[model samples]
Target: MNRTLIPLAMALILCLLAATAPAADSHPGWFGVIADPGALTIRNGVAGRLSEYTVAIGDPVRPGQIVARIDPEQAAAQLAQMQAQIDAAEAELEGKKATTNSLQERLERILTRPDALSSGALAEMRGNLRTARAETRAAEARLAQQIQERELTRGKIAKTELRSPIQGHVVEYLANVGADLSTDAAVVRLRSAQPLVLRFAFDPRDAAAPSVGTRIRVQEDRSIGAPGNDTRSHTATVESLAMIVDEDSG
Candidate 1:
């Protein structure tokens, strides 16, 4: 009876020690880093030989700043031709107006002198006046069309000068000076002037409990030499959660 009692007492003590042992603390959740940023791709909108490249990789740029230039010789020639056309049209219009005015003046003089003007002569003067007015109208239309063409050419020429779309850093140059570029050809890559994000992934089972903005702890891989070594833990708020599970991981 005594030996059996000793074994029972030993069993009771062991069970009590096992039950009293401290539980492992719950691991703080892990998350992947996500970068929230924008990238810009600069493109040549005009077709021409690239004349100048004013930006280099890693150069900071501002919006509306000119970063490159295409050859403007063609554009300049086009503008000059349009200007000459406009000048010719204007001169022709002026002549037509002058002729129209002279005819009117003669008709007025003849009408004032009733005996001096025959009915047939007056009818002929009226026909001449109508023709002069028609010529003036046609010349004015031509002038207007020339002006519009000149404006369009000027716009296209302006496009040959490439400008930064956003304030950022240049990441690449796709073409160099003297290179022929086609429309929509990429010229440079730019990174947005904004804060960077770190993207990371977490286990789906553990990810379900957290919502966006939920406070959590993050641990980065130690081998990567991320800042704050020895204190590898960071307090990060959840920004988002993935909706679908990755099938390959299953």
Candidate 2:
């Protein structure tokens, strides 16, 4: 009787301790990370060595902002070369036109003194004037070609810069300064700041969960994101819910 009584007393005490132990309170709704409208991946259309970066992760960005750039040195050199060619061509054209005008004036002056030279000499002067004019025209055509080439070089230079497509914070960086990248390579990722959305799930049995139009506060996960950012929450109303649960998780 004593042994049985002693065992029963110990069992009761253990059961009471277990019952008294506190458990964490469970929230009815599941937690989810806040999402932005969407993320924008900054990329470049040309392949080259990354020259510099204007922003990094957690840095604020705006649409059309110059985020990163590849080495445009080659393109720039080509542009300068093209520009110089255009200038030279233009100068050549001007010089040729001046020569043509001078030749025309001389020919007119020679014609005015018809008795000074024979028909054969006058014909030679007119031929010289025509040749000068032809040369001027050739120079003009050369100048036009150089100008077109310069524009093509300008376009190539533009492709070296990788710009942000959305106003947001920099989220990821796939390439850094001095890194080589292929065409259409991703450089930086930007996320939109305005119009944030929250995605969450709820257990069907958890008393009453949030529904459409239900107001709630979104608490920032201070442990996960940018440091020194405000952990305060913003109020929002639920707009929609998923009708089905994920079978693998459920």
Candidate 3:
């Protein structure tokens, strides 16, 4: 019985030694993290068929750069129609003004030579002059209304252009050329190029997790197991921390 107990006691000692031993070549404070800029979806402000698609996945974009265009032909045509109406209205207004002036001249002539016309004829001439002036005012109002509509059509044409809101690379095309899009519809997705952020997960119980404003140095792990590979390093500051604990990690 003594000999059998000795072997079991030796086995327990070996297990303890293994559990306490430090892992080989492990570096302290080393953790894996990912670096990337977040994505943004670009949307259209007006509804129309896409006439131009000027970007694809992985294409670099600049702020205010035109990435797509909705077809402006409809708006342009509407504007043309409005302009024609305005022109016709202007011509009609001019004609009415000419008639009003001619009637005013005839009334003045009769007033200066009162005996040249009878009282009934004079009264009728005054009534005709008033009617002509009213018609002229109505024509002027119609012209003003047409001009306002033309300006509105011009505004619609301006909204057909779709531009990138930031400096980034395109990640996706939500709508393709010739596709009909509605107002506020997403046209493409982009990943921002500036201010790259580093993200990593850690145990919730860890007291050493970096807080906001803490500076950190990140080293690439590409050199691991490679004889002559050079490791890259980047410096960053912690800007935020997740408020909710990750259930799987925690």
User: lDDT: which candidate is best?
Assistant: 3
TM-score (C-alpha, index-matched) for candidate 1: 0.67
Q: Write the per-residue lDDT of candidate 3 for residues 1-250, one digit (tens) a residue.
A: 1211110000011112222333223334545545444678888877889987788788999999888889998888889989988999999999999999999998998899979999999999999999999999999999999999898888888889778888888888898789988889989888875455556655434455556665555555676777888865555566666554333431
Off by over 4 Å in 2: 1-37, 194-211, 214-250
Spell out the clash pairs found in candidate 2. none
Model 1 per-residue lDDT tens digits across residues 1-250: 1211110000011112222333324765334453436677889887889998788788889999888899988888999999999998999999999999999998888888888878898888899999999999999999999999999999989999899988888888888779988889998778775543444555444534555665444444565555654524444454554454344542
Model 3, which residues run further than 4 Å from truth? 1-40, 191-208, 212-237, 240-250
Q: Please tell me which model should have the higher TM-score, number 1 or number 2.
A: 1
lDDT of 2 by residue, 1-250 (tens): 1211110000011112232333324553356766655677777787789989888789988778888889998788888888888888888899999999999888888878879889998888889988999999899888888888888779878988778777778888888689888888888878775456677666544565665665555555675656665664455666666565344551
What is the model-wide C-alpha lDDT for candidate 3? 0.73
